[model samples]
Target chain A: MTTDRAHSLKQLRRMLLVRRFEEKCAEVYQQQKIRGFLHLYIGEEAVAVGALAALRDDDAVVTTYREHGHALVRGISPDAVMAEMYGRATGCARGRGGSMHLFGAAQRFFGGYAIVGGGLPIAVGLALAEQMQATKRLVACFFGDGATEEGEYHESLNLASLWRLPVLFLCENNFYAMGTALARHAAVPDLCAIPRAHGIVSESVDGMDVVAVERAARAAADAIRETGKPRFLELQTYRFRAHSMYDADRYRDKAEIAEWKKRDPIELFVARLKAASVATDEDVAAIEREVSGEVERAALAADAAPLEPISDLERDVLAKVVP
Target chain B: MTRTTYREGIRTALRTALHDDPRVFLMGEDVGKYGGAYACSLGLLEDFGPERVRDTPLCESTFVGAGIGAALGGMRPIVEIMTVNFSLLALDQIVNNAATLRHMSAGQFAVPLVVRMATGAGRQLAAQHSHSLENWYAHVPGIKVLASGTVQDAHDFVLEALADPDPVIVFEHQYLYAMEGELELGPARASPWRASVRRAGADLSVITYGGSLPKALAAAEALEAEGIRAEVVDLRSLRPLDDETILASVRKTHRALIVDEGWRTGSLSGELATRIMEGAFYDLDGPIARVCSAEVPIPYAKHLEDEALPRVETIVARAKELVARRG
Candidate 1:
């Protein structure tokens, strides 16, 4: 149908932008430009692009440090993100927070927290605010399969389910948590089943397929907004890059990587759009060119950005103290 | 003026906060159905219902993180760790997330959270549960630390902490929980932000707080027998320290004696001594004397535990030595 073609084309563009953005980050990381733990969201573009499409602009998003893709898909400009990665004042957090911590107040994107499972409770808390204030906004919390083992994840889920907070927990199960496979860390290989144990309604979708991810996200978001009950989505995905700049790639095999690479989300979505005649090769090339230029501009802006002076260190510690 | 016990004063503050604001709620282990481990939250469950006075599981990190999350979500959450020793389990959440969120977010988020727990020794509950670690928290950048040594502050500071937009830790002394006093039943009135001069004198300044306050006060009184005047100051707030009060007292006395419950090495006394040296180095008549607990884990035996913490006798001797010495 026409609707399917339109959706696939849109997803193709979004996924291309994310994939290109992360690839650019990897290239720059090799040049000794951006430092610290830079976790690339290269192959997991569908998880962010597809799921982000289902939610409204006002919905809050809390994600892990591998969140450049999420921040970009959530409408934070790639230039600001790249500049932030460069630790520039022009970036999202004014260069105070780098890759592991990207903030976008305008878009209601809470941040990219570095600590595994740290953002779960924060996301739940944001949903709790919406619930208590009678707001219709839903909070979409994104984390990796590694965060599932953290106690904060379980506690936040239990509290969210118990209180019936309007929250959608989107887990990007890339099958690896910082080079350690999910099978090695988690007792339950099926991450979706873990949320169900906390009485949360859950669904596991093929994260490599943008259409499936979008479909599940749409249903989950609608249910949460309507009933004020939490829903969980486990998107089965993979990471093409190492966990960080320091990874030796010893944890996983090349055959496994090749198998997942064969089903690359960006290429598959572009192919689907082409098959339906909704997008030509030229259109795909144009989107990629646009995304590449934007990423480049962001990096340029960041490189020129100034670092914060040491004198203002004591500022913003407390909002207001009633002395 | 209405008279009340230390426990009653804390209860009154919690009751007033809950009654005044719908967003303020208390969450901790044994704080609800069990009526709190210290009985400071006694009858609150019956008054405010189980929703506001939540009883959390023994999972300190998870619940503390939940409290931080709840605070982030617009609720003023009061997380109570039963003791200072148990709070170590939740240190990751307290130090990493709760303390750093505001700075990391560039002032976008305000953690209006209050974490209250019992601290210090003398109850024979030694080693694991009897240590005082407020100094460790005070050393952190973002958090405000308060040690309630008196009945009035134990009752009033909780209200002040809830009103503060940053995270605050209120350490209630375990030994002083039962010490009763007449409390004025009017609006809460105590400076939660500054130290108070409990017993003003001229010769030497006895700087202390929490479990060591009573000992310092007693030592000051005992020093009066030797014709020496020792000013006693209750360091109510430790973090945004009442630097002016301490400096003024030290400037006037020209001598300082620090009484602390924590051990000697890298103690809060060392920090205060550095501050005094930096602020009023020329005013000192002699090197600062520090009366701190022996550098050993508090033993379970009553006598050994008593000997482990800073005692009135040790404080008196330290004061005498400082007064007798010439710079």
Candidate 2:
């Protein structure tokens, strides 16, 4: 197999893994194994897998609550991610942060910030640290189209632009914030314009195309590294699942969902690989089976993981006092 | 020993922090060009340059959240909010990110951020500018809240808060900027977490912090003149509550009066009173009392503002009432 074939195969594997992992999460959520606002990255897998593939090992990533894909693609262990969802002691965050707050310092995956636009400034600050330290490490900040309405989003963009911080602002434009659609929430629905207004380089990409997202992310990341200035990418994606377990998704039309599903990222990528002769039908089926097995193993490991001791509930509130 | 104003003490601490540590930087609105809102950071921008002393746009949540991120990214960021009221614009970052990040991340990260803000109602700054909302921050668990009342504290607490591993919020009393006192220059021996007994007496105990500390001391002086020796316990640290010192003072005095500039309902003073009732209830010869701000918005007028906040007269009166009820 060629190098391009290998990369395409890896990307397919990651996207498949995220899809199967989230599907398992939804199934378990129905069985009451994992609880509390479970926001799945069902249709938005390409945005996380493709965009995160462009980052350097030293670079940072700050993402929103719908971040299982981001965590998985950022190289956090599947067992740890599943254990966090299970609220187990062996989880990445030791079961403290649930589905909405996955964090891993070693991976430089800052957090799965639950607040709409809360992670933007944190990303800017991380980039600001890199700039101040005179390092080449960049930070990738991910948010939804809904975050554009937040003042922090505007403030973060202005600061990132003004300071010339090496930041890649990845706007996962999934069209809705919870139940409120972008048309209803934002005064200007064009999110790319908002970043461009802040004097930052901005572009919109087909988020459903994994190759397109990866190309855009790499270009944006390169631009930020070369110029030490922030760049923004509005990945036009969509969430196929309900906003959370509680959401009935009354706001969106079934027709619109069906229309978006026709452009399903994984199916599109699989077809592209097949047409390009990069992967065969057997190859795709094998990748799907492998990912399904991996996800099942993760779920089993998470279920077997022990609960964090209740006596340590007050631990880690502050840094341990060194004697 | 040098006599310095609270404003100068704060400036010295900031300057010292910047000079001593390479990782320390200041970022806030008007902190660079306009000095500080209360001139607490005057002349440091010219000395340290713009990078260390940053002047940010009028966006509180972003800058404060940036401070948290900077702290997480291995820099000590001292973010100054013009006043307690303006700090509310950044409350989400303060409460959600700064305060809860360490715990939520399960100790993977600790935000060593120092947030400074002017607090309390005096100088007639009106409701928007003058608010004693330290209690709101003190109610939080992860972050440590400090109230600097004396010139010595204003000089020392900033340095100590910067050294703290967790996020620390230092509430500087707005009215205390020009307050002059003898500050023994050098390393401070007092810990930021411990409550100090500024004036030791046995008749009654006046527990207070921040802008109300001076008023509590003045009340103690007045009680002294009335042959009632009142002990004054300055609660420098609000979050941890220094329950041992408070209980010790209450046990000695046998009477307690909590003076807080915040409203009576859900105030730090109420927390202090409850602690006393829990630990020193049998030791108390009389019921615990508190002199808190009136439950209305602090008015603009000088008289009304003075009447709304806890004052010397009210503290004196409350102290006397508590002491008289003793046996």
Candidate 3:
């Protein structure tokens, strides 16, 4: 509906929204309102914003614990997700899932699969169903590079290829897979090898560049749409923060963190947009203000949200009894 | 009147479900061209075509997890994991994903997944292939456990599982596949949700399920010859256990003898004994007793395997001993 410039601006705003929302989340987490493992998706915004921009809203998404940005970009209201993190009754998951287990069934945002590589098989299932139904929708399954250590990583890749299911396997290579670097964990740090080994068409993209990410995702999505097959993308990006709130920065070198920060996804995207005459400094400032307002309002609403009643403690164990 | 083997009972259910529902499909190792590992899904692939009656590449976890995923995505997926031993590989998917999805999503999503597997020991499959892990699945919340003990149940329970909105784990005892019985439909048969009294007696209640049902019934018959009439209760639905039927039978008989193929230590029989004790502590004529498999891996030798499992002789002897003892 919008021109390329307008679309580019929307993607930039989404990145800013993800950035600011998580920033507020980090702030809320300090107050202990958002308990549990708060995995802020502050740095790796482009990967979600750019990649999701290229896909249709009907397509399914199954991602890992670091999924706040994905959930936001995929149309889960920040207020609802924030309320979930706050353990509110009106949260998207009715306050049960917390931050790490956000679920949006209606949105086809299947989960916040906390287990490493656990989402892969679920993603394959979604794709399998879509393929069976002859739907053009593809599943964008996101996982960390550390997930390669799992047997399911190989199993899912093999199954997706064997069935030629419509799944865009997005491996957000954020360098560190929770304290252990991808190099330290994987024998062949080349993230694309396993998919290629499974005969999947694989490519790598600079996850820091929003336009580049959107372009690569569009191409891959198009290929899957036409071929009704699986594709893989190693979104080579970096998380500016620690894995979770509890993670001490003992694993990474300070210099390495700063080095990756030089290619900060948001900063790089802002510079790209400005250079291409898509936006001005004032426009960027306006988006920053708008994002800040949205995040602040979401945080306030989440703070005011009521905790779930104790009487409903054991709800949803089963949807309905067989009797 | 119709007759069917336990295997055919399951095949009929599969055929009926696939014929009726467009979203229903079956997938497992050798379910398609191989006609299932035990022939439970024989001729289904040919009837429904390969897309619906799918065969996997021996990757138990992915296929099971895929079923969980597909179930979440509006498809009724019945995933077969060859045996309970192989089902262990897919435990993460079953326990972590399927069981936790509804609770974790806080009632927003329901995983209408049906996972079927062959369980128990009899044909000398040895330790790796022979295990009764129904207690493991039944122990979890958000999942329904069904182990059909009769031909009607074996055929009908699959349809029941498909109708339910939550994940159901059906354990078709590999030993009972060839056992044949006449199908009894209509109001006489109870729903899959309740326990059925296979035989009614005024003396003591013999509670069992799956592979142990026939042995318990045979034991009850032998007791009848000795003038000690023992009631036989088949627990079709293991989870959300039909406590009313079991307790009523136990109260009427004033005695209960539990039989199960799982080991005595931390067994479903143990749970049943505790529940019976809790529910009917005062209405007992004798101390509650259980005849469980000996605490050892089922050996390949027929004699050793027979000794390890709950035989009719073991159940009869245990019931007689319990009947003789006074509370």
| RMSD to true structure for each model, in Å | 2.3, 1.4, 1.5
lDDT of 2: 0.91
Docking class of 1: medium
Error of 1 at A59 (Å): 3.0
Q: Model 2 chain A, poorest ten-residue lDDT window? A: A314-323
Candidate 3 deviant stretches above 4 angstroms: A1-3, B184-189
Tens-digit lDDT track of model 3 for B1-327? 588799998898899889989999999999999999999898888889989999998789899999988888889988988999999899998899999999999887889999999999999999989999899998998899999888888888888889889999998999999999987644354678899999999889999999999999888889999999999999988998999999999999999999989998988998899999999888888888899888998899999999999999988898889888876
Per-candidate interface DockQ score:
0.54, 0.68, 0.79
- List the candidate 2 regions with Cα displacement exceeding 4 Å: A1-3, A320-323
- Tens-digit lDDT track for model 1 on B1-327? 677788888999899899999998898899998989999899999999977898876678767877887787778988899999999988888888888888777777778899999999899997899998888999998899999888888877888898888999999999988987767666647778889999999999999998888889888899999999999989899888888999999999999999989887888888999999999999999998888888888889988988888888888888888898977
lDDT of 3 by residue, A136-223 (tens): 9999999989898799999999999999999999999988878888778999999899899999999999988887888899999999
lDDT of 2 by residue, A142-231 (tens): 999988889999999999999899999999999998889988998888888888999999999999999999999999998988999999
Task: Please list all clashing residue pairs in model 3, or write none if there are none.
Answer: none
Better of 1 and 3 by DockQ: 3
Report the C-alpha displacement of residue A258, candidate 2, in angstroms.
Answer: 1.2
Candidate 3 residue-wise lDDT at B39: 94
Native-contact recovery for every candidate? 0.49, 0.73, 0.77
User: Model 1, range A167-241, lDDT digits (tens) per residue?
Assistant: 899999999888788889998898878789989999999999888898899999999988999999999999998
C-alpha lDDT of all candidate models, in order = 0.86, 0.91, 0.90
Rank by DockQ, highest first. Answer: 3, 2, 1
Best-matching candidate per lDDT: 2
Task: Name the best candidate (by DockQ).
Answer: 3
